[model samples]
Target: MVLYGLKNCDTCRKALKLLPEAQFQDVRADGVPGDVLKSAYEVFGAQLLNTRSTTWRGLSDAERALDPLDLLAAHPTVMKRPLVDHDGQLYLGWNSDVQAALLG
Candidate 1:
């Protein structure tokens, strides 16, 4: 399983702290592999992109319209933080609901 995000990302840090045993791959540092990137897009589709993040908001309108797959493939930062992959399933972000689901 892989958790994708920047090591310093607050949500990522919190999620990691919550699941200390879980393996993580900081996308900013490790960089997602082609197969992983493709899997993320296939699993989560546009939801993988964090359109609400400051990173996404900072992008120009033109940059925003580029296909999410392309953006994710080209610049990993465009993808949402705290992506979790477990048992071949992918999830985006770490929210209360996600934590509850994981805990359940």
Candidate 2:
């Protein structure tokens, strides 16, 4: 199991706190690898990006025009928080329903 997200993000923090036993790869300190981001994009499509994040809203019009792959490659921070990969399944954000399914 691999969780990809920043350390400071609240939702990410919640996910980590909720599942203390889960393994995580902190993207803020460790930096999200290109291949990992690419796989995330493929798995979640635009859903991978958290539109509600300040990072997403702060992007310039030109930045928003970039494709999914380019967007992730350029600014991984814009990607959704608490993106979890358990085995091969992917979950975007931390929803209770999703949590229930994954934790089981």
Candidate 3:
């Protein structure tokens, strides 16, 4: 499995602690693959974007008007933390429900 997130993000750190065996990919450094980003958008839709993030807040209205994929490609931190890909299934976020689904 692979976890896509910013290494410094607190939520990503917590998720990493839970899934030590999973490979960690820092989206800012490694960049999210186009295919994976496409798949994530398909599965999670707009939920895949973290609108509440400062990164999102900093985006100009013109940038916000861009397509979700374009926005993510331009600003990886705007993605919701801990997008887990396990056995080809995509899971977004790291809440109790996600923990139960992935860790249980």
Candidate 4:
């Protein structure tokens, strides 16, 4: 399993605590792979972008108008946290549903 998120994020830390065997990737440092990003976007649609993030808030209206993938590529922090890839399945965020799926 590979989890992509910010190293400093609290939610990411929590997920990491439970999934010690999972490989963690700090999105701020190493960007998500193109294929993973594309697949995530397809599965999650616009939900892949964290509109409530500080990074999203900091962007200008013009910048916000860019494609969701472009925005994510330009600002990794704006993407949702703890994007987990287990086998070939993609799970976004550390919500209960995701926990159930991964913790199984």
Give all TM-scores, in the order shown: 0.82, 0.84, 0.97, 0.98
After aligning candidate 3 to the native by TM-score, how far in Å is the CA of 91 from where it should be? 0.6
Error of 1 at 45 (Å): 2.0
TM-score of 1: 0.82
Candidate 3, residues 13-42, lDDT tens digits: the string is 999999999999999999889999999999
Off by over 4 Å in 2: none
- Model 4: residues with Cα > 4 Å off, grouped in runs: none
lDDT of each: 0.80, 0.79, 0.94, 0.94
- Compared with the true structure, what per-residue lDDT tens digits does model 1 show for residues 16-81? 888777798978777777787788788777788877777788888888888877777666887888
C-alpha RMSD values across all candidates: 1.8, 1.7, 0.6, 0.6
Pairs that clash in candidate 1: none
Order the candidates by lDDT, highest first.
4, 3, 1, 2
Runs off by more than 4 Å, candidate 3: none
Report how far residue 10 has shifted in candidate 4, in Å.
0.4
**TM-score-best of 1 and 4:** 4
- Per residue, candidate 2 scores C-alpha lDDT tens digits across 9-101 of 788888888778778887666767777777777877878877887888999999998887787667778877787877767788889877898
Better of 1 and 3 by TM-score: 3
